[model samples]
Target: MTSSPAAPGSRLASRLGFSDRVFIGRAARRVADQIEAGLDLVENGLAEDLRVADSVADAASRYLYEAGGKRIRPVLALLTAQLGEGNIPAVIDIAKALEMTHLGSLYHDDVMDGADRRRGVPAAHAVWGNSVAILTGDILFSRASQLMSRYGDRAIRLQADTFERLVMGQLHETVGAQPGDDPIEFYINVLADKTGSLIAAATQGGAIFSNAPAEYVEPLRLYGEKVGVAFQLLDDVIDLSAKPEETGKVPGTDLRAGVPTMPYLLLKTETDAASAALAVQIDEGVARIADGEDPAILDQPLAELRDHVVTQKTLELARTWTRDAIDALAPLPKGTVREALTRFAESLADRSS
Candidate 1:
């Protein structure tokens, strides 16, 4: 199930023609391969230390490790590290740590978001229940931190800071859900803390691994931040636009949860007074769905509102962030890694999930 990295020239060419299915198919396979390498590092590295623990813990760890993810953050770290001469082992260890942290967050996030499925299967919480899921996430987080501590690399501080940002981002989203906050600002801040922080970690961790200059670190950080925002925006857009079969989740889950996302905020901004009133009604209807009311009741209004506003605006915002992300990488050296990352940024806008 492990993915392999594509050849450099092929990867670069794929980026140049990202919209082409043939090119994208190859590029995705390459990304998947690189991600699998990092996941293997995380799995084997942790197994060596934790295999003697209780069978439940061991099983939970194995289940999570096998359930595969995009491994975007680790790939970012690995590719960025390749920009400078460095010990590959150390770079990979850092990449593994980042993936561990990310998967840990996803575990907790599924619990918090009440998600039923992930990677097209039952979520950790669904398989093991909340308490075990929570504990599993804690174990992963601790293990990731422990790896950094044992490695005693200077990048440990950066990893620690990224963890703090992740927590802060979760808190920001929770608070933003309270009455009276501007939805747009809430989403922006949430994205900054939740998505941007890890991306920043990936870039900074890469720079630290390679002992890259501070000037180089700063642009990479910016690139990660912008790309992270673009990534999240696309995620929200796909949630609304993609089929549930493709995304492996119910569409409009955010709207149903009464969570204010970029699309919802844009809908609010674009609607006139009458439509705004109708929008509120739709919001209330969606909120009722969140409260366990059957979603079938909101179908008509939701469809009308979506057609009137949300979808188009979300796409437009995604494109804007993609451009911003590309610009952020302009200061970096022109190479295959940079080209691949830039192509990945553009792909965000068109992602199905």
Candidate 2:
């Protein structure tokens, strides 16, 4: 509890490896240390879990898992477990499984997104092609399920339900919103399915596996889902970052690729002359980029869009989600878990990357 991330063999010997957008103060620091220790075990376990006998499948399956991610999902899992028995073997095991599932999902996401890179390296789909990449995802899912099976039917059901939501999210996104569907609402729901549901599973599963009060489970679930939404919404804003150095991707990349961001989606909902005018400009910018004009040609429009009121609207909406997420912790009672989670929600409200 007295050690920092740099200290050897005390607590938090390694870094948290994500944005410092969680926990606060000395009490929070103690909680963070405990979570960090659990994460160490999860990291080591994932290596063993991800190992495969097939030479080629080995490389493909380990691709993104080794590439390095924020591991926020597992972090959440371990953190909520603090509310009960702390990082028991079951909690660490489930966190590792959740992370493997998350890592696997990224392989599928890269293939589906046609992404060139992931975690600063060439995407598996780019390296080995789509079929191999998708297969890699399946391999990781199998590994995760094997890990979960040791925990009994509850864990199995959790993995199955989360995986189902992951599929439904992709299906809905691929088909596009139905006629008469509120596009904004549909998009948020899709985000929930794809992002929030898994995160919810992580948070709730933490409490459950740790033997925390049953009443705490749903609140943590709600908190996690909303926090997940807020996290992705912030990513939408980050996607528009003019500084490629920060986001490691092009500005307005989503719009150019015909993928809609909430800011751009909000453009349709706004009837104001400014929003209307900006939307028209963005439309033209997207067109030019699609027509083989330099991606840089869209930079100014993106910068303007980045500063537009709709951008503020996007940010405020993110705040609203976080506010609701924190409120979901009301049933958690006053304690380190509740306070740490509240800080976590607050931190996401301001994350730039």
Candidate 3:
């Protein structure tokens, strides 16, 4: 399983960087170079995009950006943009918009989850309270829209669709499993909407804005969504496996929050009385922690759940999704971009094992 936490983007970045013994072709290196150069522009533009005339809005908008991130979505956009003119002005703008949207969501997530930290710093909500944190998210969404406005109707529509899916995912997650609903399937769908949709949009926007062939558009979108699923599934494994220092968050934060992970959900599928008892213990512990009791009470349950067979099942599912993501690339033409994409998908699976 995931024995240690890695830097946010380092797994895929290493693949793109050609860290393996197999020599990356010249074209692959060129695509990698283009992405590297584009990242600088994205970083600089992100700062400017988050700036505002109002001092509080400016600080709040820039808070997470300053804390730093893997910038995986934006970099994926830049990489796919190589299918056409690399780093076109429109591509840069789209990358910035997608990143802004992600940052905006994180602000809202911290508030909803009552998270204490993000990116190794205190969460915006923890520092500024819920109202300010929510407003900060709104400000970033507004800025993202402003950036998208530069691209006209099609871009605006795409942004709206992605935003809709993002909100709907959070809503479903908050409302939770309905009567007779398959919790496993329900959770997977939530992940697709929450994490996958925007990532798909990011890569699709890159291809569209860069004027890449129409055929590549759908394939990239599919690839992106699957990759996003794989990424989050690995995160489920990492949340239990990694130390706080490694992941930049406390182990079992989701458990303490009473949020059901894939592993927990899978365990719920078990019919054995022993499994049932463990699940009950975990549910009780999570409920206590959520009700403001000492989180230390969860230590035993969390440890037991982490080492369970269900956790291994979750890791295997993550690998299956990663394989499916690579399969989505079958339609793309043989080139460095396609190769890099395949490697990126594989790298995600490698994280879980």
Please, what is the whole-model Cα lDDT of each candidate in the order they appear? 0.70, 0.83, 0.84
Q: TM-scores for all candidates? A: 0.84, 0.91, 0.93
- Candidate 2 per-residue lDDT over residues 1-353, each given as its tens digit: 02122235323323232324455567877888888888778877777777789988988877786666667788888889999998999999999889888888899988887788888789998889899999999998998999899999999999999999999998898888999999999989988999999889999999999999999999999998998898888888888887888677887778777677898888878898877887887788777767878767667777878887777888888889989999999999797778877877787765673
Count backbone overlaps in model 1: 2
Better candidate by lDDT, 1 or 3: 3
TM-score winner, 2 or 3 = 3
Which segments of model 2 are wrong by more than 4 Å?
1-21, 284-293
RMSD of each: 4.7, 3.9, 4.5
Clashing pairs in 2: none
List residue ranges in candidate 3 displaced over 4 A: 1-23
Q: How many angstroms is residue 28 displaced in model 2 relative to the true structure, after the best TM-score fit?
A: 3.1
Q: Candidate 1 on 1-353: residue-level lDDT in tens?
A: 23223323223233322334322456455644554455456446644643427888877765665555555676577667656654366777787778788888888998998988876568899989999989988888887787677557566787788899999999888766558877787787789889988987887677677666666787788888877887788777766653678775566677677676776677777647867875787788877887889976666665565566666777777788779878887778766556766777766766743
Return the top candidate by lDDT.
3
**Candidate 1 residue 131 C-alpha distance from true site, Å:** 1.6
Ranking by TM-score: 3, 2, 1
**How many pairs collide in each candidate, listed in order?**
2, 0, 0
lDDT of predicted model 3: 0.84
